[model samples]
Structure formats: structure tokens, C-alpha cells
Target: MNTLLIFIGCGLVTYFSRASFILFGDRVKLPETVQRSLAYVAPATFAAIMVPAVLGDDGLANLVPPSPQVGAIVIAGFAIAKTRNMAVALGAGMISLWLLQWVGL
Candidate 1:
């Protein structure tokens, strides 16, 4: 019961925090620098996640590069560049990885 109340409290705080922006956007103008920084957050976050998955050894340090995974990432990057759609890139990357696996990569 206590845990549930904590979760509900957190959810309400999150909801109100976001709702505040919509509730007073016109009156509260963010600084240009902050807006610019916010614009880069999505891409920066993406790189932070993807770079590690692509470069880091699955769990431990390994001298050899995982070529199959890298190849899939490259193909996904190309799909994103060309199509500019994350869903398409995700599907293409998943298919590429599955095919590579089935082919005994």
C-alpha cells in the first residue's frame, strides 16, 4: 500500500510538471540557449545508448570487433539517413541482424 502511494505520488508529480509547460507556455519563455540544448538532447541520448551497444563487448572486454553487429548498425544508420524514419530503421536493423544470425554470423 505504501509503495502504491509512492508510485501514484511520483506519477502525479510527473504529470503536473509536464502539464505546467502546456498550461503556461506562452507566459514562460525559456532562454534560447536552453532551447538549443534541449533540441540536442534527443540525438545526444540516442548516441549515448547506441554507441555503447555497437562498440561495447556484450559483457566483457574483447579484442576482436563484433563485425556482424557493427554491420547491422551501419545498415540501420544508412536506413535512418535515407528514410529519416526510426521505425523503418529499427525494422531494417532487426531484419538484418536476424538474417545475419540465420546465415551463421
Candidate 2:
């Protein structure tokens, strides 16, 4: 019962916080520069979350060893750069990762 109540409380909080944006965004009238900067927020947030997970505490030094994950990321990055398609990038990354792992890298 306590866990159920806690979950309900958390859900309400999350919903209200997100709903507030939709409900009040137009009234807020943020500056043009701020609005423009908001476009980068998602990518910046994604990088912030992913970079630490990918690089770990050692950061770039972790890449010194041949890692399947790093190799897959590089392959995916190249695919995205060349093809500019997310599906292609994902396919390239997954396939490369599988191949690398199969080769016991």
C-alpha cells in the first residue's frame, strides 16, 4: 500500500511538472535568445547523460584499449555522418558491435 501511494505521488508530480509547461509555456514569454537556446537542450542533455556512461570515470583513457562498445560508437558516428540516417546509424552500430563481440574483441 505504501509503495502504491509512493508511486502514485511520484506519477502525479511528474505529470504536473510536465503538464505545467504545456499549460503555461505561452504565458511565460521567454526571450528570443532563450527560446533559440532551448533547441539545443535535448541534444546537450543526451550528451551529458550518455558521455559519462560511455566514457566512465577514466574518460578518454578508457578508449586506450580496443573496446567493442567504442568501436561500435565510432562506426555508428561514421554511418550517421555519411548517411545522415538514424536507422542506418543504429544498424551499423549494432552490426559492428555484434561482429566485434563475435571476434572476441
Candidate 3:
């Protein structure tokens, strides 16, 4: 009924929005200006998420676990940069955070 129709409508919209890209990937080209802007998307997106987390009241650092979170994230970033292994980086980072918090450091 109403619920089912709502689901169907949402699904159709989602499908079209996604499919529209594939359906016309090569048919349309973005201008050079737009292309350059698109290149900033990843850094912008990362900052959008990380900036708020790292900075809090008075723009002070809000380390993970409120103390060693910064250290953990640094370790994680380093691991990711050096090894390029996501799971290892995340696992090490999270473990470091927990260990620091657990030890009451």
C-alpha cells in the first residue's frame, strides 16, 4: 500500500540517479575547471570529517579517547602511509587507543 509505494518510489529515484552515471559516462565530459575542482573532492571530504573530530571547543585538539586519540590517529596515518594496509593501520590505531585509555594514560 502506501508504504510499499513509498519504497518503490525511493528505489526508482535511487536507481535512476546511479544508473544515469553509467548510462552516460562517456557521452558527457566535464569542463577543465570542473575537473580540477573534482580533484579536491577527496581531501575536502576527508577534512570535512576529520577536522571536526580533531578540533573541538576553542578549536583545541580533541584526541581520540580524548587523550591518546591523536596519537592513535597519527600511528594509523603513519601505518597507512608506510604499509598502505588499511586493516593493519586501523587495527593498530584502535588497539593503541584502547591500550592508552585502558592504562589510564
Candidate 4:
């Protein structure tokens, strides 16, 4: 009974918090700097996640030149930027990596 009540209370609070945003957001205009910063949050966050995943050794930062992952990243970035197609970029990058590995380069 106590747990059920607590769950209901939490749900009501969460609903109100989200509902408040929709109710009041249209009336509020964020500052330009904040809006601009918000625009970068996604890409910056993506890079923050991906960079370490690509470069980390045992989850530690390892910055070295001629890294194959770096080459794949560059190719992927170019493919995505030019074509704006995630599937194509990923496919091309994976194929490229396989080729490089097979050729022993």
C-alpha cells in the first residue's frame, strides 16, 4: 500500500513537471546564446561519446597518429556531411575498414 502510494505520487509529480513545460514553454523565449548552445549540445555530445569509444584503450585516452579508427572517422564524417545519409556512411566506413584490414595496411 505504501509503495503504491509513493509510485502514484511520483507519477503525478513527473506528469506535472512535463505538463508545466508544455503549458509555459510557448510563452517563454530562451536567450539567443542559450539557444545557440543548445543547438551544439547534440553534436558535441555525440562526439564526446564517439571520440572516446574510437580512441580509448581499455577506456583510457590514447592519441596516436595513423590510427585506423581516425581514418574511418574522417571518411565517415565526409560521407555523412556530403550525402547526409547515415546508412551509406556507415556501410562505406565498415567496408573501408575491412578492406584496410584485409590488405594488411
Clashes of each: 0, 0, 1, 0
Better of 2 and 4 by lDDT: 2
Cα-based lDDT at residue 85, candidate 3 = 95
Residue pairs in collision within model 4:
none
List model 3 lDDT by residue over 1-105, tens digit each.
Answer: 699999999999999998986887788887899989988989899979986675656355454335677667788899999999999998989999898778876
Residue 4 in candidate 2 has what lDDT? 94
* Native RMSD of candidate 3 (Å): 3.7
Model 4 regions lying over 4 Å from their true place: 1-29, 58-64
Of the two candidates 1 and 4, the one with more favorable TM-score, higher being better, is 1
Q: In model 2, how large is the Cα lDDT of residue 78?
A: 100
Winner by lDDT between candidate 3 and candidate 2: 2
TM-score of each prediction = 0.67, 0.80, 0.67, 0.62
Looking at model 1, report the run of 10 residues with the lowest lDDT sum. 58-67
Worst 10 residues of 2 by lDDT: 50-59
**What lDDT tens digits, residue by residue, belong to model 1 across residues 1-105?**
699999999999999999998987889889999988998989999899977877666633321545567768888999999999999999999899888777766
Q: Scored by Cα lDDT, where does model 1 land? A: 0.82
Task: Please provide, for model 2 over 1-105, each residue's C-alpha lDDT reduced to its tens digit, 9 standing for 90 to 100.
Answer: 699999999999999999986987877888899989999999999889876776767778768785777888889989999999999999999999899989988
Residue 8 Cα positional deviation in candidate 4, in Å, after optimal superposition: 14
Model 3: lowest-lDDT 10 consecutive positions = 56-65
Which model scores highest in TM-score? Answer: 2
